[model samples]
Target chain A: MSRSSRTFRGTYFSCMSVQSVSRILAVAFCLVSACTPQQEPDQEPQVRILELQVPANFPEPEKVMAGYPLSEEGVELGRKLFYDTRLSGSNTISCASCHQQQLAFTDGVALNKGAAGTPLLRHSPGLANLAWMNGTFWDGGAKNLESQAFGPITAPDEMNQNLQELVSELTAVPDYVASFRLIFQDEIKPAYIARALAQFQRTLISANSRYDKYVRQEPGGKMSELELKGLTLVQQKCGSCHAGDLFTDNGYHNNGLDSDFSNHSYEGIFQGRYRITHHPADVGKFKTPTLRNVLVTAPYMHDGRFATLEEVLRHYSQGIRASPTVAAAVMQGAEGVAGIPLSVEEKQAIIAFLETLTDYEFIQNEKFSSPFN
Target chain B: MYRIRRSGFYVAMLAILFLAACKEEKEGPAATTSVTVSFQHVVGSEPLQLDEVIYTSPAGDSYAVSNFKYFVSNVKLISSAGEQIYVEPESYHLIAQDGKTSFELKEVPAGTYQRLELSLGIDEELNHRIDHLGDLDPSNEMVWDWDTGYKFLTLVGTYTGQTRSGGLVFHIGGDTNYRTLALELPQPLNPRQDGSSQVLLQANVNELFQGPNLIDFDVMNSSGHGSGPSLIAENYTSGFITVLEAK
Candidate 1:
């Protein structure tokens, strides 16, 4: 063949091969596009619905929730994690097992009974308005609810479940596995589980109390004349440390339950800030808990020694034990070893004032309840 | 044949365009240079030595230093070229009696520095953030865990005098009416080309209690060890940098 004819033939073949490859590529691209899932144009975007209602004076809802941003997925996952019995080693106890809904989220027993039916050292504090609480547990051992959740789960006497095992069990549940993956985006660690629970707990905002309504100037929310007097007394005596909308100042104080407790030094369980600092001065110091739901969360103090609010009032009135750690303000008189002396009328007034802090709306909120139902 | 030549020319043009684009990226801005700043703690015109004799307080309370520890953080270096380099957050260096007082500031651009800004203790924000940096994290030691604030300066010593208390532990750091102190120093430091400079800081432990109403060591050790006076704020403000002679 001539040189031109040979070159022309080669060009023709190359062009045909290139066209064939392009056709093949186009077919593959179309097939891939057809196989991929297509979202419906009319389909609504998946939005998380947080059903919790915020109070009027309770700061901005978004700002309050900054510490714990809630979502439909996170709340659902957290609720499942909360009530899941499989979280415990025996698969018999869940968080709801101790923190029952009917009993104001507190186990009715004077002291919490653990997994092995062992009596807990402290009371199972009611978990109603934990979002406002600076510390958790009666003695204020846990700094935040995130750290507090770990205590019962891993306690030998409590749930008695290992974190690794709990994670494995959670991952085994396909629904939980998918939910956790969605919420955490592949970082499905145990700490995230605690964070989600903390977030859900934070959504448990309790501001619909008679006192809250009274403060907001809402109808049927006005406090009685007696309650007003009691509130004034509270402000004068207890308001220094337990200040602001959230009753507790989030500080540690020696309330002077007793100088000595059944052969154990008051300083031992006073474990206040000492546990964290290992300092001698912090002996017998315990964080001050919020009095928001104090009326329902009875059997007060770190030891749950006082079964009645009356007893707690009386203890402050006359039962203070003197120690070097006792705040100087409290130890003003009585030769440096005395509790604030309150009269019977004053005690009753304080109790009446504390009752106003109880929010019935928080207890009956359906959103904070178990989602399984 | 003309069509073939035209196709070759198009390919050559595409290659040239690719090379031109690559050249722009290769000739970018000059790289950033960094330097290190080393801080040395000196007491009384000399590097603080272990077991050195230093007065406990202004009450003429004298004691040989057994253990002296303080935190230095929030470091900032002002370069001569007008560039400001901030030390990494939560950088805590303990000036112990064992003679490890040097702290190195990394990634500081090579230039002469004019001034060094540092806080003797952790700032208020980091001090209140719980479980932040962990134990031995400068914020932890400098903080008063019980009161929920930082301890600006902690001075512990033994004293023997009428006005001297026994073993004294002065834990100070509170913004309360009588607790916190804020001190600033305007020292001119010429950091070299290597972006490294050593600034000497002297802390007069005695000057801490040299005011007319000097801190009574005995009272400090006794009933007022952790209570009363709230002298930390006053002392830090009055005598933070009594002697700032650069070495």
Candidate 2:
């Protein structure tokens, strides 16, 4: 091939004969005719009908990524894997072990234990409206739910499973293998597992709260006079960091939890956004936990430092501790004071308002429940 | 099991058919060459040694690396003829201390490549794409488990004034303001007739504490995945990348 191309390379392209052009045209036509496929009996690949809605008022997922769209099969498979303790190294824990569906997906404890009852550093976060969350985890590590799945699954203090070995184990299970084939058409790998798990997590939409209904002007969504007053105060005072409909600005802040910037590792000390960005000002910062399930997802804060909404409001009243990286918004409130001062009546009213954000349907959703049980 | 076995049989048959066809008509190694790039983490003239005090910065900050690793990805080779050959999907790699730093360019078009363009960290697309595998695999100590991005470069060491018992941890890699490093080195090379060549690259660690933006570890001997004015992040961003040889 090189010898023939080399011999004609210099002069063959510069000149063309009429007969040669006719011959080339004839050959091209013949090739086109020869390559035409006959209409034969064909088996069309099955297009699985996926019923995934992005939920009302929630933004559409940036784009359903190529190849891994949110499908029912994928979500169901994910649900099964989420509850399957086989994904854990000790075969004792699963995602549902910490993120139970009953507690609005939170483990409802300060720092939840992992596979051998090892203490996990941060509180097991409640998972809801995660489809809108651009980042994952308390420190906002793991990028997205897919990559985030790797964290707890492989962490020594968590489920503690080798991903490759997990894949092999899943392959040994016929149900898992069949389920994986239904969604992925490819063999079970860490990628498929992550995709399936992410697919399931994204469907944990919690938008039917009383607060949402009240905003949507639906029946049974009416707020009390005190709750209405609480809403006004929430918008005026707590809207900066816990801003937007999702009730989180989705950014990192040093919320005055710790004065010192010292941590054992990069992601530890709950380094917050700084751990992700490697910036010094990010020390002692953590992602603002979503207030969607605030009432139910108790034991609050990244470290579960606050046990109740009253404690949380009281802390906010004191304002954040003096730290170099304390969020500028946390330093003052609607009253322009260091902390957001609330009268006892006002605190009770706001707590009432926060309760309206809870959705009973979300915690008890059958779709997100374990396929195993 | 039956499905896997049948698929394997089909794959073997296709491989045999492809080999026969290639032997019959194909030529010139498919106009591509596999290139190996070895990144030598160095301090001064010798190779950088980890957990041992064999190096000192120009600023007199005596240090020894306990751990050092960085990502080198988004590799592209630009020829004199303005041709761009990219190492896609698998372009992202981890260059860790006592780990594999040799990156393979599986199918860089075999030709005279004048300038080799690369990033010293995972690109924003891959970093943000949550479901990536292979080198971006989470097991690799390359990922920042808390944040959404990869720690583009991590150099941990026992230094003169490290307050933390662990040591001085210099972690730099971000998509937002901190940004990934785009290293475009003028590399002239011709792949061997066998379609393989070794590209030598150097990463000088002293550049972090000795350059125009020198780090004063006396007052601050540590930086985590947090934000602050890091002279080390500033100096190390552009100073560490150097192509020793492209042949």
Candidate 3:
């Protein structure tokens, strides 16, 4: 083929020198092409590389604490890492084994079964807008986003994969090898892998919900009468801690889950912030999670004991457990104990209001889905 | 062969010239003058000692500061020529229990500075934007992980009749009570040609508890965990306008 003809192919033709092409063949080809009818330039169809665009009003990613910046290469690597079943010991479970995007990044179960097939200690908090959270895990033990990503992967009862072994498995995949080399610009390390997953998790912003629309005052964006009533109740009661667009004040509190720790059997496993701080006063204190998309991610509370929102509302209304660290706001009398007196109608209304915070678009976004395809 | 050798020599000479040009461009210009501004907390013309009783509350309770820490953010040093130099973000200092009176100002362009202005605690943008510690980073220990925002000013100490071992932890923050203090110091001392001069200033911890709104130290100590509006209000009114003087 002539030099120009070879160049027309997709690959670079740098190996062929000018001396390799015959002048006669080049001239003949040029003349023949000119005599033939002109053809349209071949243009490849554009592939949608980005599923999520950084919002204009969204704050710049702060150093590590706010979250590492989301990059295309990092996110792609994270998506592959997220769906790779080899992350589990039996090569059947990954992050997606528990957090399925269709169910709004939470497995549709009252309690998720771990790799050992034992019910997990707590409900899986959906991985949505996690970058905005001050602390990670249900009880606020993990200090930063990078530290939070490592919990499930190494948990013996959970994914049960060693960090070093996981890295080795990922390095063995040629595609992953190439992708990691591009994303991290070095051989895959556990920290970099965790950081990449965090970058992807940060991009899981779910601000386009019905509540967001109502707040923004977009056309056809308004809450129903029931939703409005529920919203008012939420504003009066829950808005103090679960405040603003992020739906969390990012503070730890003892919401009186169980006052009686005398059972002793559940003491060590479910001691909450006391496990991290080792202070008796900190016992049963857990970080208040953002209530955004509460309707989808069910089996509520740190222990996932409440199977439904109705049960959660009931717990707030009457199921308070008195403790030394129970929030002073929740405590009414001198003995320091109280629960919100939400009525049945009011409970339904609050649930209605919470459902409005669910963003259907975020759950179905192809960008955040498994990249195995 | 001679022509090839000559061309090779010319290329080497051009490469050397290119490298020399690149080096000159990279080095740029050196700073001609520099000044260090030191903020000292002083009460009644004397540096406020840690245990010294500065001010008493309305309720006859004896008050002594065991710990005092606060954030000073968005600092700027104004030049005599009216040029303003912005301090880098996270360039804040926490006045701790352990005495460290001076914070070294970095990357300040050499010039005669007229005044210094700083925002107390964090600005609203930075407060909402950052997740952990917010404006209070390594410079301050005002960060309470259990709470969301920085403690604008923390004055924790024992009251005469406190039952607790540590006495009390007076942590204050949130946008409601944080106050921005700005001051004009003595005009530009001659900029040291060697690019180093010290500008000393002082803060009075006593003034932080007194003035129009008197904080009942005993009541404040016993208020128990979390912050109260009354305490926050007192913090805002008392420590709002910190007087700055040149030494």
Give the number of the best model, judged by lDDT.
2
Flag regions of model 1 displaced more than 4 Å.
A1-54, A58-68, A138-141, A260-270, A328-337, B1-247
Note the residue pairs that clash in candidate 3: B33-B110, B34-B195, B40-B201, B40-B202, B40-B203, B41-B203, B42-B203
Residue A47, model 3: lDDT of: 18
Tens digit of lDDT per residue, candidate 3, span B2-61?
999999999897565444434432253445334565666554455555776543434555
Among all windows of 10 consecutive residues in model 3 chain B, the one with the lowest summed lDDT is B130-139
Cα RMSD for predicted model 2: 10.3
Tell me the deviation in Å of residue B186 in model 3. 54
* Top-down lDDT ranking: 2, 3, 1
Kindly list the per-residue Cα lDDT of model 3 for residues A146-214, writing each as its tens digit.
Answer: 545666776778888776687788888888777666555556666566666776787788878888888
**Which DockQ value does candidate 2 get?**
0.20
10 residues in a row with least lDDT, candidate 3 chain A: A2-11
**Which digits, one per residue and each the tens of the lDDT, describe model 1 over residues B27-96?**
4231322334344444434554445555444566665455556666655665544454444434555565
Q: Residues B76-186, candidate 2: write the lDDT tens digits.
A: 666666554444434667888688979777655567777676766665666775455667765566665545567777888776643423367777766642434544445
Q: Estimate each model's TM-score.
A: 0.53, 0.72, 0.52
Worst-scoring 10-residue span by lDDT in model 1 chain A: A2-11
lDDT tens per residue, model 1, A1-373? 2110101112112324677857765755654555556878567334264655656676433233232456787876777778888778888998988776655677666777778787877767667656666666555555565556666776678898876688788778887777766665543455566767776777767677888889889976988788998898888878877776667676777777655433333323445555444466766677676788777777677767888888877777676777767766455356765766678888888888888988777777777677777
Question: Tens digit of lDDT per residue, candidate 2, span A127-204?
Answer: 887877777876676667777887888878898898778988899998888777666665677867887888888888
TM-score leaderboard ranking:
2, 1, 3
